[model samples]
Target chain A: MFAHPFLQNAFLAGTFVALAAGLVGWFLVLRAQVFTADVLSHVAFTGALAALAAGLDARIGLFAVTLLVALAMGALGRRARPGDVVIGGVFAWVLGLGVFFLTLYTTVRSGTGNGSAGVTVLFGSIFGLTASRAVGTAVVALVICALLLLLARPLLFASLDENVAAARGVPVRLLGFAFLLLVGGTAAESTQVVGALLILGLLAAPAGAAHRLTTRPLRGLALSAGIAVASVWIGLTASFLVPVLPPSFAILAVASLTYLGAAVGTRLRGTRPTVVER
Target chain B: MTGTFSWNLLADLREMWSLPFMLNAFRAGTIVAVPAALVGWFMVLRRQSFAGHTLAMVGFPGAAAAVWLGIGATVGYLAFGVLAALLFALLPAGRGGGDESSAVGTVQALALASGMLFVALYKGFLNGTSALLFGSFLGITSRQVVLLGVVAAVALTVLALVGRPLLFASVDGDVARAHGVPVRSLGGVFLVLLGVTAAEVGQITGALLVFALLVLPPATVQVLTTRPARGLAASVLLAVVTVWVALFAAYYSPYPLGFWLTTIAFGGFVLAYAGRAVVDRIGRLAVAP
Candidate 1:
């Protein structure tokens, strides 16, 4: 599998996407913003569909829409983290827009021979990545990971206790807005590897497993990234071995199973999962 | 796609409804809307939107499995939806906590992955997959409509029987439990009901657009009112109207029914939210003297 050029591109792109997703997802879970991530994933799908309907590059739609909506959500919610009500309202609207675009694309573009474009956007087309696209994805993923690391400490402080961090002049709201942008970027990038529908698995499962296993912030972060990368590598290999299995399914299966294992292991060890100090 | 709208509204509606499929679509849409709105009101009140989303996603795999086994997609939708709901109830009630949301995400991922696997394994053309996710109003057989009516009736009756106690438990679980209400069992029952409602709506709005009918109408109503009876009634009204208008619009235009349904529901939510904000500001100004 490694000998194939497409497989090589898949590994290169998958590794970076997993790293960024894991890092950003740590903050997402810590802040209890998994729902925000969910909203962004759907937004990615809608944006891509809208772009396709308008006859533009899907990548342009994927990134631009997710970024805009992420900032808009920050502005809508208090402290840049939207409440469930706001998220639900926005979520429904985005999916509605997605349906509109799907209809438009199907009606006008059906005979153009790219009938599966919508499906590819929904489920991801990681193996179809050209070398250049893979490289582009890697560079974007690295930037997201670097920006996240640079802001990790302050972000953690803000996430753990928003009011205290605000009082201490940590620019809590600004950090929150910035963090949402990173999440948007990560969601868009992960859409390439796992598709819009299952990006949450890459984002949440590894970080959640790491949370269950450890309390130290830095260790958990590293553990999350490691587990995510491992899931990608294992999932890719499994898909390669069993051609009937999709890469997204394999990756998510591994990732979620890891979380389940951690939950069961912590229970068996007789240690309750540690709640972050508020 | 069809003739331009004329000044005569009733004539236009009659022309649109002259088709057999449109009539069947209307019947199924009305059947799905009421219970979906009712159950969704409680889901929003209880802050289980994530869980609701997960149950909807579960329907995709269910449909895929049904297709794989050469069975009706409805059976797969209802069975998978209820099974996932039961599984959720078995977990400790973490109620909007980080753990519960994470678990919900995990389940959504696994279900979607399985859906992909089933799609790959199936040998058929799978052309209807788009319709499964985005919904279609073109082929609503009478048998399907009758099946939907029966499910909706059963679900609505169960909801009515448990409605009062369930509201109490949702409002204050601890106090309700102390008062001898079966809070835990009620939660389980509510989840099952929600699952059934989601399955029914999933057929009309597709697996993804279920949120349009389920969440948007109820959320909009709650934003405008706190009275339980009024809110519930208004939610149903909003949902039914949205579905009817969407179906009518979809028939005349080239856009899909799911799009029209969601867009209209979302419009109602936005209107309600803005209206509430304006009223609050005016009240505050009035009191400032």
Candidate 2:
């Protein structure tokens, strides 16, 4: 599994994504904007199509649009903000754009008889990874990791107690926008290996499972990164064994199972009831 | 092309009473919206909106895979959604007091990654790609209608029957658990209902926008009302109205139903919020008298 170029590239990509996702996702989970991040993935999709339509690189388009969208979202809500409403607005508009772009792309192409190029972009072609693609993913992941490390404490403070963090002099708005951009960049990089639709799993699942298994934040983050890497490796290798299975599904399956295992473990532990009350 | 919008939507509206396909779209939209409103109420109340979105995203890859393999996408989608939901239900709720959002967010990511991988394998399915994005309310067959009907009925019935206890648990989980309401069990049950809601809505709204109906209405209702029954009523009304209006708009305006419905729903929310703000301001001025 490790010997194959595709698997090796996937491993490297997955590891990088795991680290970034582990850190960013830890904060995302804390902020309760998980759906907001997922919406950005759809936004990324529309951006990809727009870029392709303009004859630009899809990845660059995806990152750029997602970054802009994230900034717009962050700018909407201020201290004691109604962030969810803004997120909700962005979510609907972005999805509407995705559908609209697809329709436009298809209708125009059909008139010219160029044979559906847009459809291929949606499903994504992860097996087409080159050394450069792998290297690009690594660079993005490293930058994200470094930024996350610098901002981790302030971010944790903002996430856990926004009012207090702000009163304590954290630039909460800038940090929030920066974190959103980080999530966007990670999502884009992960999209290359896992595709846009499923990158959320790489972003969210390992951290979630780790959250369940531990209470300490740093320990949880470490566990999340480890779990994310393992799930990706397992998924990439297993998909190869099945021949017809897509690598994204393999990543999802393994991650979901890992989550399942952690969940069951927590349930059986019966230490504390497994339901939160608001 | 007609630049002016007319009663053209009425043609689709009237045909809905006569044509099986049109009727199916209406029926599908209505049935799905009921459970969507109900389960969505809890989703909003508990801040579990991300879980619902994640369940829907989980279904995307399965739907894509089903299309690639020439199978029913709904079945594949349902399987993935249920799995994701159960995993969610099994996590320790107060492990770090941050378990809910963090856990759900992570799983949402995992589900999405899996979906992308599966979608990639089927390199040649036109319907699969379109179906995953825009959806085809007009394209649903009688078989899908029946399937959706059964699932929707089960989901709505469960939601209705469990309404009181679920509310009890949602409003104050610790109190409900102390009173022997089986709070944990209800949480699990709610997630399953959310899973079903995602599957049904996935047919009409596509997997991505499923959260629009499942989360938005109830959440908006939450902003306006404090009473549970009022909130439920408001959510249902908001959802049904948004769906039909969007359905009509899509039928006549030459735009996809998902886009139009989302637009209408979002517009309605803004208008409602604005109306409340204006009314409150006027009431304050009047009180000065």
For DockQ, the strongest prediction is 1
Question: B1-289 in candidate 2: lDDT tens per residue?
Answer: 1124556666545765566776788888887888788888888787666667778776776687677678888887787778778887886564433456656655665555545555556665556566675678877787887888899888888888888999999889889989999888888889988887898888778887787887778767876887998889889998998888877666656567877777777776677677888999999999998
- The per-model DockQ list reads 0.79, 0.42
lDDT of 1 by residue, B1-289 (tens): 3556777878987877788888898899999999999999999999889889889988989988998899999999999999999998987674456767777888888898898889989855456677788777777799999999999999999999999999999999999999999999999999999889888988878899888788999999999998999999999999999998887788778777877888888888999999999999999999999
- Runs in model 1 with CA error above 4 Å? B1-4, B124-126
Q: Model 1: what TM-score?
A: 0.98
Sort candidate 1 into its docking category.
medium
- lDDT, candidates in the order shown: 0.89, 0.73
RMSD of each: 1.4, 4.3
Error of 1 at A84 (Å): 0.7
For every candidate, how close is chain A to the native chain A in TM-score? 0.98, 0.90
Over the stretch A80-108, how does candidate 2's per-residue lDDT look in tens digits? 23265556655866776677666666665
